[model samples]
Target chain A: NAGVTQTPKFRILKIGQSMTLQCTQDMNHNYMYWYRQDPGMGLKLIYYSVGAGITDKGEVPNGYNVSRSTTEDFPLRLELAAPSQTSVYFCASSYGVGGKAFFGQGTRLTVV
Target chain B: AQTVTQSQPEMSVQEAETVTLSCTYDTSESDYYLFWYKQPPSRQMILVIRQEAYKQQNATENRFSVNFQKAAKSFSLKISDSQLGDAAMYFCAPAFFNAGGTSYGKLTFGQGTILTVHP
Candidate 1:
């Protein structure tokens, strides 16, 4: 089952370059989230969308943006990448607040 | 804002032994939920167990169980009969809801604890 699919499993970007991390879930869930995991660190919330056209900034939303235009899609945007932005990104969807979440494999990104 | 803390960066246990991972959280809201997520080498976030603050009984799933102390604000996970597959990074998270019950699943996560199971 294609529960959650993420594009570009691995990516390398030069400083100041921009890129988009695509995330889509086939479960038709209403809540979607973006999180980043630094080396040896726990995942931190970047952005979350409760429903289509509704989005909110998470704990570490700086340098990142997200849009939930439909139930199946929630893409994260990095306008000007920096070395600090290098980390593993995960997209997740849940049926309700704090409920079990289905996550994508992850996107490993490195900024040079 | 809520906060969660997992002081231990690493832990280990024998294949057949038991291990408990500690987690503490602080929140003002009375209604909330707690979760333990496991991330193995595949980078897949799997749900280990969940506990609601209002529920007095601890949450248990197969060999996974949680020790939830409401007053102490502690939520620790205990894995019985540990196996090699249980070796992974575990995260403790807490989600709070307001009077209207709209939290968006916003979570405060603790620094993960890496579990090592020695065969």
Candidate 2:
């Protein structure tokens, strides 16, 4: 299986611009998550989905939204990109809660 | 809310030497899970090891092992025969299971510890 896959490995956005970070998994996992990591910092949960059609905000959900239409895809949307949004984003999938999660390579976003 | 903390901001170990990274967490739940994830320069998060709070037996993966002290809420990673490839940022995370049977599966991560391995 390809496991977790994320598109647009790197992106640069100007202030107020918007874009979506796509994430897909072939493992057919029901749990998916979106996390952001600042330089030399730990990962911060942004949004998560327990299953298709169920989405919830995590620790740092402001300025971001997510949708889980299919078990395979859970994309993160940036409504109005700000400089503070610049960070490395990672998409991960797992079979269930507390299960070992498989992570994507990560998408580096730079908002100027 | 549960929180994970890695006291050390950075650590270094010589080739074939041993290194330990300290991680402590605070939670009210009686049962939970803890994990250590390693992120190299490539930006891919790899699971280094995991431990269940209820398990008294420490978890070990080849050269990597964990000292799980449930009473102290400490979960430290011990790396033996440290290799150059072990240089990376290590994250300590703690997760709790939701009561609804839907795994919240959200990990609360610490600030992170950057491990450097010198040859």
Give the winner by DockQ. 2
Per-chain TM-score of candidate 1, chain B: 0.95
lDDT of 1 by residue, B1-119 (tens): 78899989999999999999999988888688899999898989898998988899999999999999999999999999999999999999887777775566676679999999999
Misplaced by over 4 Å in model 2 are B98-103
lDDT of 2 at B93: 88
lDDT of each: 0.92, 0.91
> lDDT of model 2 at residue B52?
83
TM-score of each: 0.97, 0.97
Query: What is the per-residue lDDT of model 1 for residues A1-112, given as tens digits with 9 covering 90 to 100?
Result: 7998999899999999999999999998998999999999988999999999999998899999999899999999998999999999999898877677888999999999
**DockQ (Cα-based) for each candidate:** 0.77, 0.83
Where does model 1 exceed 4 Å of error? none
**Poorest stretch of ten by lDDT in candidate 2 chain B:** B96-105
lDDT, candidate 2, B1-69, per-residue tens = 888889999999999999999999887765778899998889899999988877899999999999999
